[model samples]
Target: MQVSTILLRMPNWLGDCVMTSCAIQKLRVTYPDARFILVGSKACEIYKADSLTCIIDESKTYPKTQRWHFKKQLVGLGVIAKIKAYILYSLKFWQRNRIYATYLLAKSIGKADLSFSFNNSFFGALFLCFTGSKIRVGFAKNARSALLTHALKLQDSHSMHQVQKYEFLIQDFIEPGLFAHILPLKLPQSTQSLLIDDKQHKHIGINPGAAFGSAKCWQKEYFIAVIEAFLDQGHYVYLFGTDSNLSWQITQGLRHMSITQQKNFINLTNKTNLTQLVDSIAALHLFITNDSGPMHIAAASSTPMISIFGPTDTSETCPWNEKIAKHYFCSHRESISKQSLVVESNIAILCKHLSCAPCKKRTCPLVHHNCMKEITPQEVLLIADSMLVS
Candidate 1:
C-alpha cells in the first residue's frame, strides 16, 4: 500500500517510546509527507515538534502493562497471602468491561492507510484490530497474531536492542538502498551542544529518579555529591522528575532544600512535563542521569550526557545514536562493545560489569545492592567536567 496516513501505537513507558525513534525516523524518510497519528501518552506528545505528526493522548485510557510491570504485584506475596491482590490485578486485564471500553476507544481513532504497534500488550493488538486501518503490523506475541496483517515474532534469543527490533520490523517496509545515507535523527531544533547562560554560567540537568524501580537507580549520595560539585563549580543545576514528591525524596527534605536554594540550583522536578523536559534538557550544557525515561529524552535532545547504568542491560536500553548503531546494535551480540556509541564524541556511559548485574529486576535482590552503589560520584563529575567544556 502507498501509505499516506500512518497510525503508530507507541510503547507505554517513556524510554521504550523514545527507543522507537530510529525506526520511526526511517519510516518518516520512506514516507516523508505521510501524516503520522501517534496513539500514546505524554511521551508521544514530544512528536509535536515534528511537522507531520499528531498525537492521541491515551495516557489514562488503559492500564499500562509494559515490561511485565505486573511483577510488582507479585512481589513479597505468596500463593494464599494476597489472593485479593492477585484477583484484582488479573481482573484489570480480563474484565469484559475494560475489553469493551478498549474497543470503543480504538473505534474512535478512525482509519489510516497503515498502522503499527510497538506496544507489546494485548491492548496494543486489540487497538490495531478496531482501528480499521488498511494494513496492521505488530509483534505476534500474547496470542495477538490473528489480528495483525503482518505479525512479526519476538527475537528475544538474539538479545536485540529495542531499537534494532523496531528497525528490523521497519527494514522490510523501507525499500533497499532508498536513501543514500542513514543518519540518526535528533529531536527538532536540538544540536550536539552545550548551552551557556548569560555567556557565563553553564546549565546542567540531574535526574536522580528512575521510573522502572530502585534497582535501576544510582545511589542518592552520588547524585548529591555530583550536584554539590556542579554548584561549587558555579554551574546551574536543574533537577528533573515526574513529580514534586520525587524532588522531596531525592533532596531528603529541609536541610538539603536549603542547600539547593542557592541560585545555581533549580528544582524542576514537578515543574516540567515531558515536552517541557525535552526543551529543558536540550537547553542544558550537560545532563547527568540514571538509566531512566529522562535519560532517554536527554539523549534524544542531542544533549551531551553522562548516563549511569546498573541492573538494566545497557545493550537493551543505552542512549542510542547512529554511531552507537554501527558500533554495537548493528553488530553481533558476541562482539565486544568498545563503548564508542557517543554521538559527537562527547557522550559518557558508565556501567560496572558484575555477574549479578542486568538482572532486570525492579529491586536489588542482594544484601549490598552493590551494582548501583559501586558507581562513585568522582567518575560522574569527571565526565561532567568534559561535557560542560565541550
Candidate 2:
C-alpha cells in the first residue's frame, strides 16, 4: 500500500486524548515507514506534536469561523449554495493550510492519503469523509459509518480498560498479535525538572479532585485521612490539578492541618503542561485519587495507587496495572448515594459491599448520601495499616 499522508482524528477530551496515545503507538508500530499525522484539539496540540511524527492541529486545520463579514454573507445564501460555500471554505482553508481557513480543493478528494477519526460522531466522520481519503477507519458505531471504507466494532464488555479500547480500534489495520497494557510517554527535560525539584519538606502527591464529576470524587475527609496517614509514614502531599481555581481550593487549609507529616503542594496544578504532569506523577511513591486523568497517568507510570470508584463501573475503565494494590467502592448498587460516588482507597481494600450501594445518581434520589457517609476515616486507616504491614 503506497501512502504519503496518514491523518488521524484524535479524541477531543483530555482523558480520551491521553488514552488515544495507545492507538498512536499501535499505528506507529503498524506503519513504521509511513508518515503519521494526527488531527487533535488545541488543548492536546502540544502533546500530539511533542509525541507523534506529524500533527495536523484541528484548531489550525479546520475553520473556526470565516473571515470578517464575507463568510457570514455566504451562510445567508440558499442550502445548496451554503453547502457549496462551506465545502469551498473547507477546501480553501485546508489548502493554504493557512492559519485562516478559506483555501481551495483541486479534486473531489482533498490532500490526505488515508484518514481515521477516533471518535464515532457523525460530524467527525463526515468531515473526514469530506476530505476523501483513500481509507477511513473508526468504530463501527460511528454515525457516519456508511461514509467510511472501514469500520470496526467495539464490544460492550468490561474486560478491558478504556486505553485498551482505543488500541483495539486500530487492531485490524495493524498486526493484531502485538498488544500493550498502557500507552508510553516521553517526558521533556523541562517536565523532568518539575519532577526532580523538591525543596519542600514533604513530597506526597494528592489528587484531591476528580474531573469525572462528584460521582467519582471520594469524600474530602478521606483525602484528609490519607494525607494524615502518609504524613505519619513521613511523606508530604502535593495536590495535582489542570485548573488553577481547583488548585487553590486544595491548598486552602494547608497550614492549619493536623496530619503530622502533611504539607500542601497544591500549587502544581494547571501551571505545567501534560509532560510535566506525567513526570511529576512519576516522582510519587504512591497516588491516591478518584477516577480521573491523573489517576490514569499515575497508574500508567506504575505508581502504587489506591483509586476510589462510585458511579462508574470499574470493570469498564478501572486502572488495569497491577500496581493498583487496592480499589474502594461506595456500593455497587443504585440503591445508595445517587449524587456522589463518595468512596476512599489506600493500599488495600477491606470491605467493598455497602448496604445502600452504587446509587449512580449525582445526589441521592432519596436525599441521603448514606453510602459514602457510612465509610469512616478509621476504616481507610485500617486498610493503610494493613497495606504497610503486608
Candidate 3:
C-alpha cells in the first residue's frame, strides 16, 4: 500500500517543536517519500521547515498584540488602511488552506480516541479528522479519541521522556517498534563550520534559563559558583541564553570571580541560530542545563549532560538517551511536583540540609524562594567534577 500524505500538528513552543523532530524522524523512516506537512505556530517555522515540505503558520493568521506596538499611537487613515490590507491578505492565505483535512501531514491529528475536546483545545485533532485523511495519528487526551482512527494513549508526568513518549505514538503506524533505535539529528552545515575548539578546555556549557519561567531556573549564585569551580580547575565555560541581559550578567559575574586564569566564559546568547546553537552544544564535553529545549537538543545530539529539574517532572521530559543524560530529581516519585524538581539532590558532597525544600514557585509564591536559594553551587560543581574525570 502506498503512504500518501502526513500532516503533523506541532507543539506551540520552540522547544517542544524541536523535541518533536523525533516524530518526523520516525515518519521519514516509515514513509520515506510521502509528502510531509507541518502545521504549527509561526515561530516554529525556522525549526520545523527543514523537516517538512509544507508549513501552516498559525501565528501569522492569529496575530497577537505586540508590546512595543501597544505604546505607539494609532496612525492616520493611511496606516489603518495598510493594516487592514495586510490583515485581509493574511486571512485569504489562511482560508485557502483552512480546509484542514486536505493537509498533507494528517497522520496523527484525528481519531476521537485522542480527542482534544476534554482539554478544550482539540482543534488540531479536529482539523486532522475533518481533513479526511485515512491514516491519522495523535495522542488521545479526551473524548475526542472517537474521531481518531489511530490514537495512542497520551503519556503523563510519570511516563517516559517526551521524545520517547512521542516516538511511541508515531511508531504504531509503521513496522517494528518506535524508540527501538536512538533518534539522531543531523547538525546543519553552518553549525558544523562554527564548531568551538574544545581540545584543551574542560568545556562546560551552562544554560541558566527555562521557558517555564523563573520557578524552573536554578539559583544564579549557584551557577556562578559552578563557573568559578570550572575556572579553578583550569576549565573553560560556555554560557548560553536568548536574553542579552542574562548573558551580560553571567559574563560579568564570571569576570568578577576570584579565579587566577583569564576569563574563559564565552557568552553565545543571540549570537547563533538554532542550528549553530545545536552544533555548539554538541561540541561540548559536558552540558548542564535547566529543563529546557536545548537540553532536548543536546540529548538528540547525544551530548553527555546533567539536567537540573524544577517546575517539571524529569520522567516526562528528561533527555531521551539514557546513556548520555543523568537527571537529578529533587522530589520523590509520588510528590514530584515542579517544586520537587528544583530541590537539590542529596548526592554526597552535593548534599544540603533543608527539610522545607522544593517550594516550587515562579516568584517564590511566598516571596522567598529558599529551595533554589539553598541548592549551593558546590553541589552542581561536584557533578561537573565527576563528568570531567569521566
Candidate 4:
C-alpha cells in the first residue's frame, strides 16, 4: 500500500492529543513514509519536533466544545438544557470544521490516502467525509457510521483507556495485528530537558487549575495546604496556572507566607510555550496535578507524579505508571527502563462512589461537587511525602 499522506484531526485538549501518541507511533510504523498532517489548537505544539508532521493550527476544528461552556447553558434549564446538550454533544452546528476539512484538498495536502479523527463528534465524522479520502475512519457514534469507510463501534471500547482505544483502532481497522504494543507517550528528541540548577531544595509542581470544569478540580484550600507543606519542608514549589485568575487565586492562598518562604513558590503560569512547559516539567522531582494537560506531559517526561482524580474515572485517564505501562507495551518502547531505580507514578482518587460520580461531565450536574471536594489535602500530602522521601 503506497500510503503517501495521512490527514489526522487531533483531539482538542492537550491530554487527549497526548493520549493519541501511541496510535500515531504505531501508524508511523505501519506506514513509515506516510506524511502525517496533524491539525489542532496550540495544543498541537507538542508535535512540533516530529520532522514529518505538518502542523495545522485550527482551534475551531470543533467550537464551543468545552465542558464549562456547556455546563452553564444546560445545568438547570431542565428539558430545554437537555435538548441543547444533545445538540451540542455532536457539535453539529459548527460548520467551520467541516469547511476547513473540505478546503484541505485545495491546499498542498491535495487528497489524503487516509483521513481520521480522534474526536468522536458528529461534526468530527462529517469533517472526515468532506476530506474525500479513499479511507475515512472514526468511531461509529452520532449516526455517522455510514460516512466512514472504517467505523469502530463505541461499546467495544467502553472499558478501554484513551491510549488503548486509539492503538486498537489502528491495529484492528487499519492494520490487523500488525503490531501489538501500546508504548508510553514520549516527546520527540530535543535539546534535552531544562530546569534551573537549584540543588538546595527538591522541586515539586502544583497545578490547581482544571480546564475541563470545576467538577474535575480539587478544592483550593486543599491545594494551599499542600503548597504550604512543600514550602515548610524546604522544597521549591512550582505553581502552574493556565489563566491569570487561577494564578491569582493560588497567590492569594499563599499570602500568609513570609517573603523568604514565598520566593520558593515560583509561578510559571501564562508563560512558556509547549516545549518549554514539557522541559520544565521534566525537571521536577515530583509533580502533583489535577487530571489536566500538564499531568499528561509530566507522565511523558518520565517524572514521578501524583495525579488526583475526582468525577473522572482513574481507569481511563490516570497518569502513566511504569507498572501499568509495561503491561501495555509495544516493540520500540520495550527495551528501555534498564535503570535499577525508577520513580514511578501514583494516583489519589477521592470519589465517594456516588452513582452520579464519574459522570465525566464538565461540571457536576447535581450542583454538589463532592467527588472532587472530598479529596483532602492531607491525603494528597501523605502521598507527596512518600514520593519525596523515596
Per-prediction RMSD in angstroms?
8.1, 7.9, 6.9, 9.4
TM-score of 1: 0.82
What digit string (tens of lDDT, one per residue) describes model 4 on residues 161-225? 67877765676545665445446787764655445579877998888888998778888888888
Candidate 2: minimum summed lDDT over ten consecutive residues — where?
A: 324-333
Each model's lDDT comes to 0.73, 0.57, 0.58, 0.72
lDDT of 1 by residue, 149-221 (tens): 9999865634676677766666667876743234553555434232234557788888888888878878877
Q: Please state the error at residue 225 of candidate 2 in Å.
A: 2.9
Tens digits of lDDT, candidate 2, 269-346 = 766676677777777766666667776666556555666665555544555443321222212322222222322332
> Model 3: per-residue lDDT, tens digit, 263-305?
5666777777766777788777778887678777776666767
How many pairs of residues collide in each model? 0, 17, 26, 0
Report how far residue 7 has shifted in candidate 3, in Å.
1.6
Better of 3 and 4 by lDDT: 4
Residue 111 deviation, candidate 2, in Å?
Answer: 4.0
Error of 2 at 154 (Å): 3.2
Pick the TM-score winner: 1
User: Which ten residues in a row are the worst by lDDT in model 4?
Assistant: 334-343
